[model samples]
Target: MSRLVKCENGHFYDADKYAKCPNCSRGAGPKKDVVMEGGISTDLDDVKTVAMNIRGNIKSGRSVRIPKVSGRTIKPSNEILDREEQRMRELQEKIRDHKDSLEEQVTLAKESYEIDNDKTVAVHVFENGIEPVVGWLVCVNGEEKGRDYRLIRGRNRIGRDSGMDVTIRKDQKVTREEHCSVVYDEKSNLTFLVPGNGTLTYYKGEMLRQPQQLCSGDAVEIGETKFIFISFCEGERVWKNEEE
Candidate 1:
């Protein structure tokens, strides 16, 4: 079938050129003013010929026309919308579970350093790069001193109290009852505090927020005992001077 072309006069033509709209003829301009439907191959020769013919048609003040397609509307089905929602929900659940897994891992790692009893002694290390570690001494009656022994968390100067590094030694046993087991506060930064039947009171700097994580070589304090903080993943306790 011959390719159909629409002309400015609203006429459909198989002919390469068509008449121009009479309404646009008042200016007495050349046929170049006519607008034709696009789909034709415009080789140089064809362009010249079509242009010349259109010019002539415009001079004659005639009309050209083309066919118009009937408009149609499409709407998505309910099933499609339902499937999209389901896919989105699945993706959301996947994200949530991944986060939960990370939190669980952090909890397990913190719990690994939990001190078992009051007599069990272990240092709270904050070697991690972020967040300061503080040490609060637990009183015999089971209360963390809010004032005395409230050393700020962070790097403990080499000659602070008795003049010793705060890092924990390899082979030290951490007891849960006497000392606090390591636990991560809401911020995910590891915290070592004593937990017991005695009233747990906040000490100086206790109200401060914790950072997200710790870096090796960071220092943290637990009560009167100061500890060098290290990642639980690659640290060993060193013990030699225990009072028998």
Candidate 2:
């Protein structure tokens, strides 16, 4: 865009070429007999400016133009109006999408950390013993995704109950507690999925009737949620006391 400026005195000048309005800085002068758009003078009357250079000021090399007074408001062209409406609609849609994303993040944070007995307070880890985290149960399919429950050195009970060690609270079909068991044997350094009080725990598309050894990528299904088991205390990497 042209960086030209029009002073209140109707003088058009390149602002980049001067600090202040050059015409206004020149001080006041007697009113010119003619008012042209690109004409530079302090006494230039209240003439409306257009996009063309005045014929009389051709020698000045500026492309500023002023139109004779018509005393009418110029309405924007139809193309300009349409473009403005489209821009407003797009902006509104972007704002709506951003609001929805923020709401989802806030909801997830509350469910993961809030101290309510009904929701999850899984954010804090209180260690009464030196039990090391031996594995992880990450929910791969459910109302929530990418949420991981820690598996400690001993039995990590799985259920929807807040009191459960490996809680999957979003799935209603899960039992309140003891939906299943994910156990880490410290002596043998192996992890196993043990059937709980629930009707059945599904592992590898079959009902688990007995304790089945779990591997790093084994799928376990209890109620409506699916989890991918990952063992950290296997392959000679078992956790032990520092002094031991």
Candidate 3:
């Protein structure tokens, strides 16, 4: 009983005495082994050879011409490469623009927060009975050394006694009480340095005879104690204190 067999060339034959298809041509039949000079036997029918003279070209130091494959060896054109580069550049630009937009939004948010903070501070100042600190007297020489006395809208008495507003204990030259007074008039919105009847008080390197209108950055000396007046009410109208 012979069975049907398919050859490499796609021919079907009866596998009765022959291993290959007898109906096919000899070239399309089974491969024959051929022995080379190196005693290597290879099937000549299965071996593939190039039609061009590759060995001769390689020996002459010439570049071998390789047959290009349909899709593998074909390189992209300069125009296609340029298009890809342009697309990459456009993507980077979009990223930079997005980053800048985020930064701008952050800046705007910070500015809004600062404005709100200022408004809240202003509201707190107006709502409470807290008098806005008009100025401060920084002690230049005294036992209460390096301390600052807040000058508000009222009579600020300075003397050696602790009962006074600003006491000068280190200076024996200061009187027991009421050596001088710094008065702030709410109606006139002006400050005055009024020296006590016989109290030794100097202002701006000159002896203050009567009540002198005080301003920002004024140097006042009561006995041996010295003080510098600093004002916070800047850019506002300052009225003159009329002597009665």
Candidate 4:
């Protein structure tokens, strides 16, 4: 078993065997005087010799030692620069091509509208004279008349009256006199639906306030009767008898 004890110098150690503290025995060594080399007399002589040598070397123009560096700055090659420029040019070309394709699509859409109305009307005028029999009206709603109305080069009246060009008896909404009239334009070669006085008439699903030119596949609603306008003079001419 170890026991703790304190020395007179205030150091703690194990005191199981020794009577006096072991830490006090470590300070019993002998002292000796140390002699240093290179006294002031010899040091001054050595410093003077080094100074004289430095002065002689400077006067002789001797080169002094300096640190050397190994790395250098690098630049891109011309071929690499040319390849990057070419890649940029190709990207620009692709952007131009994409823009051109979009413009072409817009142009085609405008052309489609022109062909749907203007060009077709022009061809009809050439084939059937300026005021052409452009289309016909077929009854979609109301009484079965067993007949369709043939549109011609002049004003065609429509009503419940017997004197009208097209008559509908079963539709109570139809007026007795002139309910509506389909008129042909000699200059434009277009057909229009003109609403009569105090009559309810619609062209292309909208109420007709004034004369509206009829296009292919347009619908005309007179009173309760609905008629779809079918154009025959748009693409190719269909031959019909003089009586029709």
Candidate 5:
């Protein structure tokens, strides 16, 4: 689009743009290289330079100067740069911690339960003399209601102690160690309950005085907890004893 130009020197303007001659009254600007623009006689490269000079001189009566945004940007302060680096380092540490946690979970999953990639290390808890479970004592009363304790081939000492074969923690009335004993006789495929030394034990609704046979669904009470025996090594079903 064409535009009009107005100036102190009428010859410096035409119907199209502002053109300045080197000898004009506004000749305080830098020397321009002559270039043909619309057949007007001028040494300025383009009207942009003339407009820049005019805008500069109009503000402070100073010679043409470049605008503030024309040069390199200002550098950030030292504190600002340090703060940004600190934030980046914290974020990197958090990401690294998350990655380490995921790696640990993957390693544990591979060890505990994994697929067909490698030969899995079988759990030898029973092979190491722990014995396969022949029966289970399920709590039907007390704080550990509905919890089951597996009975091994040997005697399973029932107590609140952590080291007991059958650990019952929720019942405080149970002694710390050997409150009672549940023995599984592999020879006869029978389970027997041996009473503790000082603790009171009730089996089948009667206070137990000696070792007595325990059948399935027989209720045994020690402390405040009551358990119903459930046998697995019954008439037709028993674990095969490889050692025998």
Candidate 6:
């Protein structure tokens, strides 16, 4: 289509075809090139320099080179790049799943039971022929009642009946200030040493008894009160003899 344009001679021109004028070899447009120089920034001076170099190389008709590695063709196109990124994401998910499973196994292996009260309970041995390790619940009357974890010791003494050394492994030490009592729950009425003067008292499931000494299958009464005798549970089964 023809457009109305102004010429340099201050005259209006109506062109049928929007073509340059052959009379003065000039077009109905600006005489100089419109150079669009981007805004300059001090921080991006290096980036601008690199961009300028690339533009100069392009203007000079230089070709960029990309090396190929062994067992590979030319560097992948944009489509191949997207596929490689997806494969990497899948591998990361599998790695995370394996790590979680390993952590769960470690946590389960470290689980164990807790000791709560001071009561005699049966336990199993890991081996035979060893001095059985005694297992006592830290509860009284099948309740969690012991507040302190005290370490007490006892030495075997000569028995008055058998004229032999008597060894016992079920003695417990309690402070006189606490007014604590032994509540035995054994069926055989065995004996143990109480570290004080009063007769030891034990508690059966139903009744309490006071006796001169602590024994299994038997309860001890100190005065008017009585306590039941509780059994000793060990980690191993060993030979038992009444002689000393």
Which parts of model 3 are misplaced by more than 4 Å?
A: 1-131, 234-244
TM per candidate = 0.26, 0.47, 0.42, 0.41, 0.46, 0.21
- Looking at candidate 2, the ten consecutive residues that score lowest on lDDT are 117-126
- Candidate 1 or 2, higher TM-score? 2
TM accuracy, model 1: 0.26
lDDT sort, best first = 5, 2, 3, 4, 1, 6
lDDT score, residue 233, model 1?
Answer: 30
**lDDT for each candidate structure:** 0.37, 0.66, 0.63, 0.61, 0.67, 0.33
Supply candidate 4's per-residue lDDT for 120: 45
**Candidate 4, residues 1-244: lDDT per residue as tens digits?**
3344545654334454567745457662222222224221222222333344446557867542222222233557889999999999999999999868756654443332223345545444444465445578988776743457777554667788888867777787888876877765544556677666435788888877666778777988888878888776543455333455
lDDT of 5 at 111: 39
lDDT of 3 at 134: 62
Lowest summed lDDT across 10 adjacent residues in model 6 is found at 151-160
lDDT of 3 by residue, 4-39 (tens): 455676444445546765646555565555664445
Off by over 4 Å in 4: 1-133, 234-244
Clash totals for all candidate models: 53, 1, 0, 0, 0, 37
Which digits, one per residue and each the tens of the lDDT, describe model 6 over residues 131-213? 33222223333122332122111212211123222211123332223122222212333333332222233334222222233
- The positional error of residue 91 in candidate 1, measured at the CA in angstroms, is 1.6
Residue pairs with backbone atoms closer than 3 Å in model 4 (clashes): none
- A best-first ranking of the candidates according to their TM-score comes to 2, 5, 3, 4, 1, 6
